[model samples]
Target chain A: MAVRDPAMTDVARLAGVSHQTVSRVLNGHPNVREQTRLRVQAAIAELGYRPNRAARALVTGRSQVIGVVAQNTTLYGPASLLAALEQTAAESGFAVSVGSVRDLDHRSISAVVERHLAHRVAGIVVIAPVESAGEALERLPKDVPLVTVDGDPHRPMPLVTVDQAAGARAATQHLLDAGHRTVWHVSGPSDWFDSAGRIEGWREALTSAGAEIPPLVPADWSAAAGYRCGQMLARMPDVTAVFTANDHLALGVLRALHEHGRRVPDDISVVGFDDVPEAAYFIPPLTTVRPDFGAVARASLEMLLTQIESVSGGALRETIAPTLVARRSVAPPPRR
Target chain B: MAVRDPAMTDVARLAGVSHQTVSRVLNGHPNVREQTRLRVQAAIAELGYRPNRAARALVTGRSQVIGVVAQNTTLYGPASLLAALEQTAAESGFAVSVGSVRDLDHRSISAVVERHLAHRVAGIVVIAPVESAGEALERLPKDVPLVTVDGDPHRPMPLVTVDQAAGARAATQHLLDAGHRTVWHVSGPSDWFDSAGRIEGWREALTSAGAEIPPLVPADWSAAAGYRCGQMLARMPDVTAVFTANDHLALGVLRALHEHGRRVPDDISVVGFDDVPEAAYFIPPLTTVRPDFGAVARASLEMLLTQIESVSGGALRETIAPTLVARRSVAPPPRR
Candidate 1:
């Protein structure tokens, strides 16, 4: 007579243990007794039973894992976002598999996405802000609920982003209201959505106030780049009030202004974005905007999880607002 | 004779494709024509073939995936190290499965290690410097090769660490050589081995130079912490030179001193460690020690990979030297 294959129950019975004990051994639980584990393993070997991960996944039709795709940038924003997401994901009942793309481009992100697919991730959180990641969204598989964190608001699908434009507008308006004729901008890379948003907001504030709009200086989100912009602005006596895309660039501007004998707020009033932890300690202290990344992380997990469990596809698009922390950096433009 | 069970070659034969083509289809190779892929998939479904990952791992006894365990700290040092490690691992043709613990505790690390084991990682790089992580090393599974990046030198297994003591000594010496009576230190958390190394080095430099060793002021490696220490030191008339655990703290000290009406170098010379990218731009610039995290990453990867490939376990214990960058922060104490 043909015999049935050995099941988990059969292995448990042979080991003289409960099914839960056998399962705990298989799961690599540390609480299991060593002697008890050895017995269960021996029983499994004798019964020729295998409880591999892929086999279990195939039977259950769920991996119960989330893939977090992030840019491999050392910028505090992305790093803090990743750390916060990881912390929350661990606390919640889910496992996170992280994949960092060399750049936030379609080809690089897609390649990472394909690798994640092989692991059968239940959902993916793509931290998109680069222009290329916006285009990469089209190539993504729509079968599962995918969310983008810190991406352009215009991008499709469930998205959670910070209000970059509002932040820029507040910064610019602060300078203009303080008696500056106009505010010059030191922006991030043009291809970045954050850069574009900040530039647009700066333009909007200047136009609304009927102030002169000076040519915007471009930077690559580095203190060195900001220093270069500062050197040029320091030479131009008319460039009194300046707004930078982020705090790092602001730092460089402060250094250059100091070297060129242009005192901040006295000679060139300056403002920055992203109140990183060190912003409060910057030379004249930095007046900047702070993005609540922890809130973004919590909101993102809740939204992605809601999509993950529901049979009905819900489109969730939300933006987190940033607040201005005024320090010693900004001052009214000197009398012209 | 009874019909033989379906095999991979049988599926290839039915699809009228080469064995390599079937492999390409199962592995989701993009180079294959769509029609060819469809034909191969149809044959596989007809034969009821399953190409599961865990099953493949059991057969091959090698997963070719490296697991990277890191502390979930937003401090730039750890963040930069993790980023560098990920970048190098990706370029080295290895899949990096990252697992971050809630804290650098043995229980948490063990739990994460269990999850990684399920993925059948070939090796592990533990970026551990906390005391609990050093204790947890003994609990790791002995079958796999494990190495710690920036961990304690006394801990077991292969280790790649920066010479924190040397960095601290140079920072202290730099302050002492500038004609200061003694250098007071603002140290990191005591539980951290990194902090311990730095403290020991500071004490060594003081004892060796016939200088008095003042009380060790402990901190959590934050700029705010440094600011608090600086506020106290700035009030003290004898506190002329101060050495901080990191550049972030140095910034806070600079700010506090400025608030207390004490000018840097002329009033109080300051030095920091981990010459972060923004160090050169701090108010007066910063003279600090620079740790080459890229070199540490490369060395750790080479050691881990060698252990992973070789049956012999070579005990590799090494330390990367840190160089001091002289900047505007340190100057000879003014004549009293």
Candidate 2:
């Protein structure tokens, strides 16, 4: 029987520090104080810890490929993030092999990660956007260079994602600033972190403004769902302003309102998120939030590269803030 | 030095039939005659042509993964196809490894294909939608079981695609049927096969009806481009009906017409393609062409599976016809 090579846990144990601290020292993260760094170095030297994956990659000249694990879907946010990441990787002279899974479940994610490891990928990025993916990320080998995008904020993992809460707050605040007494929200599926974060921000904004929080209208990320929610809201006399989770939802709301003869901005103000390319072409031209997917992609690549070149690191997090793109859809409430 | 294994071409030469016929026989296709099937089997035995990839996969129990090569894009059509393909492949108990390239050019595609080969994927699917991808598809080694989706019609390769011409004709005829004397057309980027096929169908519909052919308005697949074209069309008194290549373009056209005070279906009518999720939510729900992406994905997988289980064959094709989804965007042209 072959003996397994020494692992990151061994180094951490010898160094008298947590696994994350060991990773932080290995990654040369600036926050590691001198004493801890020296302790980690001493442990590494004593154990002959070589960070064999990176070392082997350097010797074999096979570090030009980066593995990406993402769910196969046409939804704008994940699709855009994947595209942006591929572009950024290409620009940096690396090829991307995306192991596309049917779901972000543990079994699917683990299978893809195992395949990536078999191919000797220099580093890995998992576009884990849902709650189910968090457990799998935690269970992955700690020695492997890894990063997560749009994953659980509570997980101790390297992650880069758009500030979903900030964007949602901005959208809600924009609608309230237009003199609406209170704003209603149509949110995305509950399983997604993006959805939860946006819901949080929407509630935060409403609470901060001392406005009554209306009952949440839940819908999946679809124009059809939005239209259904819109139909219900269109009949409500007090529904003066709406902030949807995304632009497609806003389009549905706009159409339902149109069919009911409720004019936009005059009768009801609307704001949306994700500022999709066609948002400006919507009936009233959607006022929406634009997350910096490019910045997030770049930051993710930088973090992954740091791990590939050195070792692992602590749960490094970078949240790119989104800007509100105010278009024609926002206005003061109707004179009742 | 190792001797090269006998390839499919060798078997084709041994048998007096075309490469495609040999493939048809090996796949147990009903079209192959009994005599031809016997001859191909005899040739296979004589040449010791084992279809080594599939045989090895069987022996090693490693045929559960399918490799897919697609460009990284957020565009609706290609993205939908990719998603559907992954879903279909998953249903068949196969994992999908996507090789995402920046371009479908020879270098990028060839590199990805090589990676897939190294991984010993059961079969490969290339989502080649652009003209540039044609040359690379043709250049790949013939022994690999491969299929191309949305590739060039002229290429001698296994391909499965939506019938763009048929969908365009349906959209054009829908407008013509609504009493528009003639329809002005806005097309997608010229380099795409989807664009060319649409132009052909649009022209054929007009010519068949004895309607004067309007000069083509060229634009990329963007709402911004559609807005520019719509501005021009809205200014023309004779432009009563406009057909855009996709739903986003229709949205832009609608917005421009709205801005110019041209009420849709009253002053002018409009039709678009791709029946996007948000199309029905457009101010006056759009009438567009809905290509069956799921059907195309299923057909592509079936074709690839047939080839993977047998020897390489000649070009096989499957073109799924899309349907016209009528909504509020079309109406009779207004009287002068």
Candidate 3:
């Protein structure tokens, strides 16, 4: 019969202290007293006990943990991406450790990356949606296994992101096909790559149709901001169609239109991106874009694993296209 | 003048390799060959370079990092708590590392706790809102500084949570105050603590008023489930008031009632919980409960800090009460 390996409980018993003390001593925690540290060390030596496998993996730099850097946010797009990535990593027998940063600036991003590297994580993924994060990504050593999601398109980095422009174009063309001559847009924060890509796509679609472009309405990714912009749109009689950067914005716009006595699809039509789960329950069920977050996660992991196994980094890029879900929110403009 | 501390980049310059290689050697990463490791070590000794403050903190076990264990979910409640906690921690000059789990089962919780211990995190916070996570919390060593958020109330562990029962009672009482004989309820998943607490409060309010207790309409936390239950409620002639466990459920209920030609506040009234950002934009605008997540987070951190400073464990419990926000969704029962 094989001998059973010594456990943490055994170390606790031999050291004449609690398991937590033994853990503290092993981790070099400052709280443990000198006497307790000596006792735990003696016990560890006596039993030939080793710390947990994860600690051992840290020493070997082969931990089955993927480090992710993400902003601490409750927004739908980034939050959905994180959840999908965690699920995908788990399915592939890897645990995810997220270093939550308050901001995506260079200093914050660099600090999180250094900590992740110190832990010797297998690979690192940074969810860089804003332009401020670009400089940090460029500064990191190119030899590290890294990938950026929803980062700058011009950056020559390994990336997997949603085709935001494609989704925007589709939403715009759908409204045009409904006999609307022009479509107004409610965009997200100006600094975000998602907002830039979406604005570009909407413009491309209108230009292709030879439709007149209206002045852009800029807003942050919040319902209150959307409502404020919606109030302005509701006062314009010629604004027959509106496409919002996200579903929450669409909800605000719908509320404003309702308050203004403008019936959806009967007076002014609306379209939104990110078909959030509650979109279908809206007063007039929302027609929106649904990005394949699961697909983006899978592609990201596959690209990362290839780099991890080969011990080389490549400038790979994959963009998943979003589909437009048709619902009651869009219709032909009412006759004058 | 003080001599500047040697940096990682300085070590790289001495080693004649990329900065990443020096990091790998310091982290004990296995990818580097013996020759490279020796060269990096020699350079480190020559330059007297210290890896970084964080790595040094790891040795002393005095890292200013708080480890948080949360399930990988996009659900509004848990997500909001996490985001708020992260913000509070950042304000207090602490970085947060989240270990995302797939389930709240005992084994999963234990594994995450062990990992946090290995990293010597200042303290651990587990966002356990399910029944299965109870046993693991009990089994942990008594000396560790730990606190649970939205965890089992029966467990003898330090915890800070939203007052779910109080919020539900307020919602029910608000409807009753509007001259409704009784209020019907659509609940969340049976196993969740939030659902159970909401049910308890609802029953208490009805019993206190000497009103008939209608059988609960069981549903999960989804607009789809709410819609299904709403369809049944709409067909019942005596249904005048409804209280749902969450805002998304209320949204679905509102949609279903609209489809059935039931005018909100005129034919039926509704109340909800969470007061999600979109609640105010819901069709008639939803009257809901707003749990102070920031307060809960601040209290949790304060309790954890107390324990860490004293190097002791206590069964501290704090529950932050939620307030009801009145909106257009509630009105006096239509004249019988």
Candidate 4:
């Protein structure tokens, strides 16, 4: 009779260690010493023992899948960030399973987490775009390795985010240097940290320049909102310059200005954030702040994986800076 | 002993069938007779024989994981389709593992597929953006359950794609009906079905109307390419109408038209496809065709899953239509 092919048992016997030790080596558990791991590996190679993932998963009760809860519907930041994270995760030999939460309510966020947990995922990355999601993530059990991207830094959970405030400041500063008196603002939704950061940065830039900060108008991150705000700004005799929270809104502002018969740069100078792909093609080619979303995503994925590696482990919060890209959108304030 | 969990042996014993027969019944193999399979199933329930997925995988050599090979870059159609597939796959209790092939070269594409095979995935979905990817996928194993989204239908693999030609036809016909003498075309990379389809539709529309068919310029799906093409068209006194393959190009076209002191609609009318979110914000809001990517994704997932179910031992192919969204981009040709 042909000799039975070597299994984990044969490798364990050859290495003079328990079958569980070989399993640990296969799973890359850090507790095993280097010598023991090498011996197990050599024995496995000699015995032709291939550890089956499904079998190991059954025994160890840990699925290799990582869940990503994102709110990427119709928003540029969230969508781009999620895509970056997916790419980063794929490079690290892990699969990111995504779930979309329409709203950041506690129930919705928590439910999404629970669904991933039911699948026995290794960890989770939450792309929390709303204020409620941060609070909900804090309410979850700390045992699971969790990292929140674009989340509030003040929140207790580990966070990886772009420096929204800095980007906003840069946008405001660009307008100031271009000889704008005061930069009128068209902001995104009120509850998002990103929105708040831009508002704060805009206020800071104005205060530092000794320019009177005008009231900020809030829009729902849509072009129509920016257009309405633009129309309103166009009517104001003293409103010579404006800053928008995102490019889409800036596009709307441009349309509103055109409708009100005011030309871009020549009539009312403008600046927007999120150098979206279409920004460079905006009628006057928008001048905007481009966030280093890829860097932020890579950093976030590394942070999450670190925590996942130390599953019963912890990680530090990281904040990355956004960059500014100058274009044709801004100009000197017209003589008032 | 935890009651030994009623292994397959117990069911086989009760049903007076071989253990392989019980395995075949559980895996839904077609070779099993209806009466005998029913007997084994009844015995399984009576004996409470729960087949361990891991052990069963070892015997049957199948993994439940579904591999989704997609492009890492940003594009509206592929990105939206992927998001929809993720949502649908989650609901069906299957894990979708993503592999991003930055290029569609045979080696790169096959390497991604091999990575999936290494994980023992049950099937794969290749979002073949370039024609080269479809060619690469053809080289993959025939036994693997595979579905191609927006790929060439010439290949024997099951396919799910949006009606690009139909949508393009609508775009071109709309511009022609608006009383344009001839419509100039700016296309995406020729290898993409979308690019080819849009070009073909535009040519067919112009031919049928007895309008002059202009030369086709290839673009890489960026606003910059469209802008370059737009700049050239702006100088032509007779270039009264244009149809671009995608929205990003239309944006560039609009900017180019504006830069050359030519006004939109009043000088030259433009129509774009994809109806990307920011399209409506274009100086004259883009009028384009919107591919129902989500519906296509849902249909693709369902079709692939049906094939898997039927082949592995359950359904049929499903196709969906694309729609057109009209906006301000197109208008009557300017009077001489």
Which has the greatest DockQ? Answer: 4
Residue lDDT tens for model 3, B1-336? 225446678888888999989989987899999999999999998975655434445354445567888885688877878778777876775556676778889999887777666555678888988888888888876656789998888877898988899999999999999999999999998888889999999999999999899999999999999999999999997999999999999999999998899989888999999989889888888999999988999999989888877855554999999999999999998996
**Candidate 4 lDDT tens digits, B1-336:** 123446678899999999999989976899999999999989987975555554544445566567888875357666677677777776785666677777788898887887676556777898886789888887776767888887775666687877777777788889889998888889999888768777887888888889888888788798999999999999999898888988899999999999899988888888888878768878888888888877887777777777777665223334466788999878898887
| lDDT of candidate 1 over B146-172, digit per residue (tens) | 889878777666899999999999989
All models: lDDT?
Answer: 0.82, 0.84, 0.85, 0.80
Model 3 spans with C-alpha error above 4 angstroms: A1-65, A91-94, A114-122, A141-143, A309-315, B1-66, B90-95, B107-122, B139-144, B308-315
Order the numbered candidates by TM-score, best leading.
1, 4, 3, 2
Q: Which pairs of residues collide in model 1?
A: none
Ranking by lDDT: 3, 2, 1, 4
Question: In candidate 3, how many Å is residue B97 off?
Answer: 3.7
Best by lDDT: 3
Model 4: lDDT of residue B146 = 85
Off by over 4 Å in 1: A1-11, A14-55, A58-62, A333-336, B1-55, B58-64, B177-181
Global fold similarity of model 1 (TM-score): 0.84
> What's model 4's TM-score?
0.83
- The interface root-mean-square deviations, each candidate in sequence, come to 6.0, 10.1, 5.5, 4.9
Q: List the residue pairs that clash in candidate 3.
A: none
Candidate with better lDDT, 1 vs 4 = 1
Distance from true location, Cα of B312 in model 1, Å? 2.2
The worst-scoring run of ten residues by lDDT in candidate 3 chain A lies at: A52-61
